[model samples]
Target chain A: MAANRSIDNFWAVIPAGGAGTRLWPLSRAGAPKFLHDLTGSGMSLLQETWARLAPLAEERFVVVTGRAHRAAVTEQLPSLGPGAVLAEPSPRDSMAAIGLAAALLERDDPDAVMGSFAADHVIADHEAFSESVRVAVDAARADWLVTLGIEPTFPSSAFGYIHLGEDLPGVTGARAVRAFVEKPSTDVAEGYLATGAYRWNAGMFVVRPGVLLDLLARWHPEFAAALRAIAADVSLLEELWPTLPKIALDHAIAEPAAEAGRVAVVPASFAWDDVGDFDSLAGLLDRSGAGTTVLGDSSLVRVFESSGLVVPRSGRVVAVVGLDDVVVVDTPDALLVTTRERAQQVKEIVAGLRDADRHDLT
Target chain B: MAANRSIDNFWAVIPAGGAGTRLWPLSRAGAPKFLHDLTGSGMSLLQETWARLAPLAEERFVVVTGRAHRAAVTEQLPSLGPGAVLAEPSPRDSMAAIGLAAALLERDDPDAVMGSFAADHVIADHEAFSESVRVAVDAARADWLVTLGIEPTFPSSAFGYIHLGEDLPGVTGARAVRAFVEKPSTDVAEGYLATGAYRWNAGMFVVRPGVLLDLLARWHPEFAAALRAIAADVSLLEELWPTLPKIALDHAIAEPAAEAGRVAVVPASFAWDDVGDFDSLAGLLDRSGAGTTVLGDSSLVRVFESSGLVVPRSGRVVAVVGLDDVVVVDTPDALLVTTRERAQQVKEIVAGLRDADRHDLT
Candidate 1:
């Protein structure tokens, strides 16, 4: 495994968050999805995220995470020093989390190109991902807010789509992002797929710190100034963090910038998964195709005439029989049994648990 | 709740055996189904069986179980005397397990009429069950090997059927056993259900101890003599028990006696369930028709649009979603997720575990 050479003036920004309630017991509030390895790989998703970026960013990295996960992020990515991992006083969603990182990086590296990626995504074929990042970094250096639009393999209504504009003159795979669309219906998604221009918006943004903050300042100047003020004082974070707007970066910046013709997309066909639910996790992990898939130790599972996923997280033996696409997630404190088609409805169970005051399980 | 009066010289013979592999993890090899309180009734199935028969037999009881399960059976039924519970050296099926008890009772009480009932069966109506046993005992007194035939509730192909002959002259519910047929096909079972002459063979037998051994002697003389010799001298149990035939009481005695016109059936309209699998166990424990049924503490389970039985035995929260007739059995070390329709297939999983040499789980 030959490592790619570190890119010049490039930094990595990892936003590790989300309770992942759809995944339920496997990914809980105490320990979210990024801290654990959803894939059977030895590395946690956060660690894998760091590994994927270390080749390009080398020692230049900034991690934005909630206060609850600060110690875990520090422990998981041991090479990241105290100054590198920024602990948010309170969650203000993606805009505040990523903008704070941008504000800090702008002061540290005057000519830096930062690629913002989520910590909980699964990326197969790292070579293709690296190539996309390399091109996105090039687009970012030119001050074009670069976003990697993943080539859609199927008509998945779960994800938002990116409409591409005319191709950038010099950049090989870079094209101007026309519009960032919200998640559409399956029938509508099929029409978008047939057009051969729409791509999955993976929320991967590459840009200079000034470019993202400048774009935010165009709409919410005070919000961008607050992030910069927190970056300047560092101690003002506790008081000013919660005062910022609670919104996703796509809605706050990316979607607006795309309409302004300031956002560019570098389309990559590498396999990517957000692992939003057990069904998606099962699909991402359906490699064995031997009727049943054991995401943990194979020895801990026993299946007969069954197909789908069985996660034995409690070191207990799980037996599934005569079921198709069934998902059984066994943990120390909770267990979930459902079909793949009903996996999205698992969030309803989490909501029910919350209503019943089962805070420990949710 | 009036307790039934003790019948003269009537002894209760409880044969507590079977691995109950269909129930798996909940009913393991080390802890069989008979020792568990599967119905959320606080008392185990073995205890429930003893309670039902204790009123009729008083202190006259003989429980034959495997050596491994002797302690558990005794612990569940603490009222039994020292010699009342017999521990077999090894499993030799129902014939050897029950015949040994009959031989011992034949000598202890010369006028003893013993009724043999399995320890793991669930009967809902105690009054009806008590009345049927009394009628079966009366038929037994007339020198007939009497069986309590349960009224078939459906066209079930899982159980053997008993064809009835003309009613006895004096006995109201007692009829001559025309034949004891094996498990029939569902189509054939439907025809059996249409005819009122067929009843499910619950394998319940009541007969005088001497008469039961005498009948055993006619077909298997040497086997009968060995059992009698063991009863006469308890020291020969470990030495001679292994040499006896391993056969069910039905195939070894009831079928032959029914063919010889020496068997009689007392049709009992009581609700009896073998609780053979999770499906039958679910059906038996479905006291509330609230769509979803919880067998253990109801508070520990959370369901959303699901129907079936959830046994939360591990003191952990179990959530089920968008499933119908689903069966979830959670234990400390193992868990089973399946549908009520495919409950029988769980036996194949148990066999697979045994074949894989996972005795710790099986």
Candidate 2:
């Protein structure tokens, strides 16, 4: 209940722009994963993300998304103010999307500490997530770029790792980030896990708007200046957006800040998932460890001697029989069938469709 | 070219009434396998069967189908005369369906030699098939209930085996049928294959109409009498159809006649498939041994590192990735996803759907 109180001068910046190609047919260019209710909660992932952050960052939200998705983002979160959603003209990647929000928040509230979380990730235990964000916010007030580090549940080769250093002197449960490592091989991830000093870098960053801009300016001065200029003119976004570098926030600011010893990590024991592929999705939905895990209308799916994921979105009966760990995603126009282990290769199909000039399906 | 010529007084009796539970969604109760184009040949199985037999039977064809499917049968075979398709009041198994045809042929043509072939089977070599039917007809003229025995392509346990006896005294290319063995284990089938005295019984029976009726009478006197009574007076079909025995033709006549040394078989080297399940259906379509054998429009299917059967009948793009021997059948009302190995279990799903009163899907 303590985590329900709104943090003073804190803003939640959500970057909602990923194609999520691995979840093809269900997650399309026109309707990305954030727009879909993958968890059968009757709420899209974007709406769930907004609900989780509203209590802590009450009425202080800035959702940065692609221009094509701006209207959808606003529609999903109707309570937000007029200027709460920032529309990027094109895909400039994570750095430009988040940094632009930081520049605008800095101009509106000089003392604003912004927490940037992706709009499509799944989080369990909202109280623990809120508590971790609270600690990260406290560290952010001390002029440090703080990230909430998730406890590694497995030796996953798909996620980057945050090397944990000594605990911060004054901030409890917050540690200095020794380094931010890229996604490693499974063997290397196992080594990282054995040391007991690495946490999953879930890309949840909290920092004062000025501190983030200054860090970006330290590495790429023009990138920071362009974003600040866009925030100043309000009309310069179209002119300056194409000029900004396309890079993830992790590479643009987090890694460099960690190397410069200005990054802090708040260790949190809460379940978090990017829902990267069908395998991860099956795990998330198959909590009972029983029959097929249906993400959509359960009435639409009928399974016999099968245990995996079936998303029946096209209002048809989906029958899965005698296949284990299979993935079947049925939409109105396109359907995907694969195994959990081979789910990552779905992106190849999407790419092939695009190359074949079947963009209508892609 | 000899196979393209019509045979004198030869009638093709097509019994087109199987649920084809294994090929669900694609083959439903309202639309069985005989009404589908499983071979990607731009024609339904019934149409293909009619085309194959038109040369031999000419206009002498009798297609016995359930009353529910009579309209579809007539629609598929538009060239058939008004009285050619005989609609049974309900299903009384193959015995009643084919026996009624035999009784009608006997009344219409005293010397009619009827060749009964299922409306939903796939034959690769048309010339060889016609040649085999010719030999079977020759044997049928000698008062023998003749069956076409397909040479064993593999040790298949899914089909009944025909035990080949000594050569017929006078009928060239035809031999005595010693016995009919039910589906056996793989090891038992392998032994049957090694002996070189067994063939897969595809249930192609050739015989004079009176001879067939006499053979049926020898086993089930009431069943034969009822069929004859229905044929004598068409008005009695609705009253007597349900009273007829619900048994397969093999059980009612062929097995008993073989035991009495009254059955003969024409050895056939042509390819034949019942298409009983998705695995068999995949084999029938994947002639090139290539990626993803699509039964419907190939343009609607996209595969990456996957091979098997994909039927995209619902006009949806079906994409398969990193799975081998997978079976995906998508229809407008229902969809089926499984592996070729597990395709046999699809019937279990159909049975479950029927049990749950989801007849709309079944």
Candidate 3:
């Protein structure tokens, strides 16, 4: 559990199983969001995420994605090998996804620590991020459920917060977890920011197979039983996986672990962005006075004397004349023009497209 | 010649011969602007032009247009009998076009008063326009070359003005033309508006077979000789029509006639709009304080308090968010977004397209 100790035998499990309807048009049912080259960089979100972890544990990397996206995941990450694309059976939430990865990884190395990462977040400072993961890995090796907690850079109400208790007796830069809080209101977020003892729960985690299995068995017996049943017959896992309960890992496991005094928080100082909404991408982009991000080969022909516009697609020129704080996404088939503050309501456009049966575009 | 005289044998010679690059994308080289259903009202400019003149002179209407648009012209106006579609050898200007129409009509009736009308001008009051044309025909019959002059409704520098010297001794609403002024500066346009003695040269004219020929002989003898030779031989006319001098009737004849004291102006109180530029259309459109005109089936879904939009096409909803005084034209193939005052410079876009060799679009 020391700082420089090699977690070389660790497996990086990316539960890339979400349908990701929030990023529609660019991401259709056939091709999910993770596979899309959102940044117009050489790698996709999944590829970038995999590449970030590949150096640490390339041989032990596993991508647990939905059956629909299994081939795409495999095709996108050629470095992962054929067996690394673990196909999930159904559209269950993060709890089942994590359990499936755990069960599959236990077959090869039961004592190995599984570092879980979301496929869609953008981490800018790789070295700092890797160091934070290493810190979390050290904490995980000591039989404590470890979570990477990003130091809040702003009063963000979008992400849940992890309150730090008194420092852990032996672990340097690691805090004893006090409590896990849901997404806060603006005032509450400001209050949390002022306290300087809160960190954004980035949904990244590190836990040994035995520790996760024990936690799941004690807290969510049904999910643990399903995983056990799937492990018994690997060939029939696809058929049985759809019937598993849909629940987030944070609600079913992380929240309970923190409540029961079994959680450790690794204070991550790396530049991290969940990139959950257009507004969230502001930090990752090069901003002008009006908060405009012209990613890839894009040029802002004319932004109407206003601000907060992010057009990420390449070879596309977008001119938001007279608009302020608006997100205008000009894709091949559709264009989305919404206020940056109302970016959360962009899901409504997806819903509208779905209700109109425009699945080809959606 | 009197106002009440009926000119029964007159033929409506429509010079439907413009390669209107000003309205590009929608108006391609293959199908010029006159063929575009701009209003989406189930009729093209050519169709509406023919319909407007059909009541005044049926079956005798002739449309001298470019060779490429002959089929479209025929298809749109099916009632135009065989040989009514006079295919121009090439896009020579209106001087040659009018000469060709005059010569063609002379083949059937030497005494026929040619009432020349442009194929694109829109007359909102058909009855009044017809009466004005009747008065112009009477003046033409009296040996004075006649032009319908629309009384100025605004100080528009976009159009030429015809200054009246005095009311004709006997003919009602007809005046001796003093001079023809070119498109004026702002001050000159204001002065013309203030005087109330100037009228927009609506480009509609009535002349006998020899009137234009006599003017051409006196002013432009070479042009007169070329037209005479082309008119005498059908094959020569076909071969040399495109290579003939490219001059507008205003420059080649009207201005000359006014200078030589041979022109008469008939004041037209009718609502006449050339619809030459976007601003002209704005005047015709029902405007709110914001200067938006929502025509046809489409709605102007302006968000963020956008203003001054004109949706002239149908079957598609156009949303202009956070834009002011900008014209957004959404066609099946192209979308044009420009400022209202700069709409006149849309011709520059057409010129650019031509320069780029996008003949399919322009």
Candidate 4:
């Protein structure tokens, strides 16, 4: 209940993966978005996530990442013990990634209430974020799969909406989720905002490790069993990780659980961003949302009469003149120039690079 | 006067100067616009100019450049003799550059008729250009300061206009110049284009070396004497060059000579471009001017739904997406991104870099 005190029996489960193709050149396949210091905070997104959760779950950290990134994750988080990092042989989507952490936590500590958060999200109000997680953890202790829903700041059609129902009878600040809606059109999102019951689904969930596995077992028995079997024997990971279904946790458990009146939501009013593209990144870095924003060394950027984002990572001087809302990402081997309006189309460039067998660039 | 055969007693005087601040990063103080191969050709602009003039002037070529660029000019023009490349101590403007070439040619060959052309202009029709030069040369032999007036294709406010008078009765394709107009506004340029008697003065002057100095003697007698004295004693070049008046040939002789009813114009129909800025460069390189155009190493550029010019000089892969009329010049030390409409403002960036003491980038 105390915001400053560490929560009892809480385990922080971080899933650090995603190429983030929309942020190419800055976020490449080998380095990815999570490993980058996109917020200009000196620490990368993964390190920031660890810093935020360390106070809430003291020394109870578990990071599951791709085999290629395991060493980098461990190196970035030196304080984390060798046994705390889990490396999956291949990508099997969020279900396997998060479920592996849950299965391991369920065997290590019987009273562990695991909170799963992505490694690349940015939260402005750390105190507000901590408060929301505290409430979510309390609801998870009651055996409910709780998600920390972000208060919608705009009618963005980019993310799904969580429809809130009546408040939970026992837990304060917790409400029963009425439904989980897929990403909708602008008009649909505007209508949803008018109703004042929708919150942006940021995909942050809190639940007991045993409760998550049990909920997954009810839907797909083999999936939960495979995760548990892999956790029982660490040597079976490489063979079992690829066999698990490649599905998101929302499709595997959250949506169906909400329909069965088992999912709870904590509507938090913190400024949160997944930094989906350069436009989102520009907004996140520049709170005023005007003028040119430099994410790397500001001395490397020379802008005039321009308003947008510039990531000068190549140590070369980047001079932008007379452009409005332009995004330029300069790396050592590749450079990307586009507009904020067309930031989503950056993924197309990455796809083209892969198709052309220029994977070194992608 | 045959267009295919070499003209008798003709010399090609190339005034290779100008830092081209508007084409910054690609055209720097050390490596100016004339040294760059902006046309996607393997040869530099100076080399291209030499190729265009070698057929007409045959071994009678003289290149006047700054002291810093003298070696580069000589290296680019290996066939030119050791005494052919003249290095200026400092930039003393067009009058000093061209007049020194004229004074030297006048002393070396009494019957010399020199055609002075810029080292960075792009000419499309080689035969038509040759024909224009031949007609101008014929008029120059008659002791007239003849300029090749380019037929105006559009109303351009960036260049000066030549007012045409009655045609010369003796020489075909030659017209007496009524006056020389400075760069005008768009509305004024439109009016000039509407008049059939106006032509774009491309600064291509062909004149007998003695007549050009005599024309200069009519107004700035001291300036002409100083240049001739420097030619008489080659060791006095650095000493007397600093004392020469810093004036363009257009103002020093062409305007005053035209007022005295002595200057003539050859109304040539060849397509010519100074490539004054990136917009002009884009138009010159992409005649159709609809899609993205890559200047250097087209294989290093990747584009999608974009139009304009991109120079990938750093051997980096430049990817542009969903931009219209954008200009991206990637160099080893600096990168520039702007729009074609604002390409002229790129000089502001170069100025800023110099003011900030980042001359290494400029």
- Which of candidates 1 and 4 is the stronger one according to DockQ? 4
- State the lDDT of candidate 4 residue by residue for B1-362, as single tens digits: 45589998999999999999999989999999999998878888899899999899999999999999999999999999979998999999999999999999989999999999999999868889999999999899989999999998988888899999999879998999999999989899899888888999999999999999999998999999998998899889878989999999999999999999999999999899998999999999988989999998888999989999999999999999999999999999999999999999999999888889998988
Worst 10 residues of 2 chain B by lDDT: B287-296
Model 2 scores a TM of: 0.97
Model 1 chain B is weakest, by summed lDDT over 10 consecutive residues, at B1-10
User: lDDT-based ranking, best first?
Assistant: 4, 2, 1, 3
Q: Report how large a share of the reference interface contacts model 1 reproduces.
A: 0.87
Task: Judging by TM-score against the true structure, name the best candidate.
Answer: 4
Quantify all predictions' global Cα lDDT against the true fold. Answer: 0.91, 0.92, 0.74, 0.93
Model 3 chain A: weakest 10-residue lDDT segment is: A312-321
How would you encode candidate 3's per-residue C-alpha lDDT over B85-191 as one tens digit per residue?
Answer: 88887788888888877876666687788898888777767778888888787788888889998988778788899998888766787899999999998788999
Per-residue accuracy of model 2 over B141-204 as CA lDDT, tens digit each: 9999999999998999889999999999888999999999999999999999999999999999
RMSD of 3: 5.8
Name the lDDT value of residue A113 in candidate 4. 98
- Model 1 CA lDDT for position A220: 94
The 10 consecutive residues of candidate 4 chain A with the worst lDDT sum are A1-10
Better of 3 and 4 by TM-score: 4
A best-first ranking of the candidates according to their TM-score comes to 4, 2, 1, 3
TM-score of each: 0.96, 0.97, 0.77, 0.98
lDDT of 2 by residue, A209-308 (tens): 9999999999999999998998899888888989999999999999999999999999999899999889989988876656788888888898988888
User: Reference contacts recovered by each candidate, as fractions?
Assistant: 0.87, 0.95, 0.00, 0.85
